[model samples]
Target: MRPRRFGARTGETQLRSEEYRLLRDLISERLGLFFGPELRSSLERRLRERLGVRGLDSFADYYQLLAYGAAGHEEWDEAAELLTTHETYFFREDYQLRAFQQEILPLLAKKERKRMQIWSAGCSTGEEAYTIAMLILDSGLFEPLADWEIRVHGSDLSKRCIAAARRGIYGGASFRATADVARGRWFVPSLVEEGKSGVSASVRSLCHFAQMNLLDDERTNLVGKCDVIFCRNVVLYFDAAARKRVIDMFYERLVPGGVLLLGHAESLLNVSTAFELLHLKEDLVYRKPLASTAKP
Candidate 1:
């Protein structure tokens, strides 16, 4: 039986057990994500909006519409947008950036190619990706590697978030944590057109934004291999088994000796055996061991 919510005019419009089960099943099948019962209220609120859009009052009706209606494809996108969380900021975790600047960039500079590629997986609004760009540029690494291709790709499941990232406009609330020097160097203050401040063209051009669902194997394959993948604050939403599976996928996507950065709360200890955990003075990172290093 599902728990009931009291003190509501609508009574316990709480998602029924069967509805919860169906939602979990559908989301897992479509996106490899499982939402526990604790997220019932959030799921209910999001689904309620979809139901209202269709003028349907029951979960069963909404499910049927999603399953059999011709517009089911559109509904799938709407559901993804509703459920995908997009909480991120410029240099949200400073320690990881410090390690990249002091450690990773210097190592890459000695490599024959002198090129570096980074992917900001689940990048919410381009802040993290742009933050990486600033770090690389500020470290004085770009000049020597000018001949090498420097690419930063930011991808998320939410099309809306991708659209916003592509626009590169942010409010003061988003910049509160940003350093004053970084703000002056990376962003040019613009007129309060439409009541919002804008960033400079230079910072905006550093990243390419795209809509990608991590669970889609083909979509993940399309991204190709990268040197550094920052998939922070994302896998905690999944179960243990799902987390392991996703971590394995990341391992395959990264080049040998490539780095993987996670959120402060996340770790690769039990989740993956393929990665060699590396502890820097400033941050914790993982590396996909080179073939020779992995061989017995």
Candidate 2:
């Protein structure tokens, strides 16, 4: 597809064919964010703001900055913020969470390892990770400090998002689906903002946040193996090849019999077959078998 001939609107940047291909391919390769031709306009619109901030007149300059620029790392961090969707709320898609609480927790509780960890991959602003901690508490399957080790690790690609997640303070739509009782139980009124609420120290204690690009093998390894991984709505943005790579990393990161929970709109079809499909009472999940081996 050719470049987008931007409208006469002020402060717009023309994304040429070569530049579009270079930028999008680099984006996919670096961050796993896809930009098909249908999204060219939207992509251009968003990056246009970035270009303005950089005072660059062409997408090529932006591409060079992202590719090999000295500030490439920091620039890519900013690009991640621009390209990704960070909007999320507590208790979203409660059905999947219900399956985690009733079905998955019991199964995990039976494991030999007393240290249980659930990684919230691509958690935006920490809502999902905090949500997982709440579920774990509700399960009452593991004691907090007596003999059980519980950790809910939240990670995202954007530093800004990680910072927000670390704060554990949220307002507005972040709590829309959250029950008032649950909110009262798990959160305290935040002095940071009149309408905001801080996630309780009990929940925050069980969780931690970090900024990680899933492609970074070093950082990925630092996450350590987990008992459950919630990568909902994150991998869909990646192209097939990138998706495969990320899925394989996840495979390596999960312990035996560990399960993966994805967004309802996502699935493993055509992505990877390493995970076995689990049909739960209220949701479908992927699991690594207790005695699993490589397919080929």
Candidate 3:
């Protein structure tokens, strides 16, 4: 492998040949994430900050420090942060939210058991989970079932994102797609002390954010069962086998008749046989059929 060179004018340093290989192997082995040569420059740029923070001059030394050092855990976290992409916004796919509000919520409202539980798996920055809460609040169906539990749990692989979600403070950029009525109903503007605008209190209370890695069985089990699971774009990064494993695990974690919403670009077609395709009039969702209805 040739060491990719970075021109000095770019103000970024390139990883040495050995350094790139070691980082690539570490990423693959630890997170099951892979990056090709095309990603070399981007990876190097992201890792450069970590190098500067740790005062390391070379990637080999940084790798060794990450692999074996007092700050090994911190290095592990930093590596994960660098590798994981957190590109999410409020109500990213409006069609899915509409389907949930118009179709799913009505069905749940009519049910004898009115409690609703939703999991925003791979929920980065708490936007998706909060969006679900807003939809539920807007639907006007929860009043009759005020006693019923309405839990929205948001989990992500990155602790940084989890923390951001927990803080419930988003800049103006996160609200661009949100409607004015929804914003007023769900969020309250706070004083932006540091040259940044803020969100409201209603949005903050709608979600519980926790640090979680989808690949960990123990963590997944702790989330228990939910009525809806939004795994979304998070799974596309994984290979087929990992994706299948994740879908199966989600199947067990959802109640019968619970819905699973995937990213628009994602499907269960070749990944798992555990879920049945559920075509709504407007959008397609997946359902974990009751045991009696599941095909043997």
Worst 10 residues of 1 by lDDT: 1-10
**Whose TM-score is higher: candidate 1's or candidate 3's?**
1
Where is model 2 more than 4 Å wrong at Cα? 1-11
How many residue pairs clash per model? 0, 0, 2
Native-referenced Cα lDDT, model 2: 0.85
Whole-model lDDT values for every prediction: 0.77, 0.85, 0.78
Candidate 1 per-residue lDDT over residues 101-126, each given as its tens digit: 89988887677876677899888877
lDDT of 3 by residue, 66-121 (tens): 77889987787777887777888888899988999999988888767766779999
Q: Which scores higher on TM-score, 1 or 2? A: 2
How does model 3 fare in lDDT?
0.78
Specify the highest-TM-score model's number. Answer: 2
Error of model 3, residue 252, in angstroms? 2.2
Model 2: how far is 107 from its true place, Å?
1.6
Residue 148 accuracy (lDDT) in model 1:
69
The regions of model 3 sitting more than 4 angstroms off are 1-22, 55-58, 192-203, 292-296
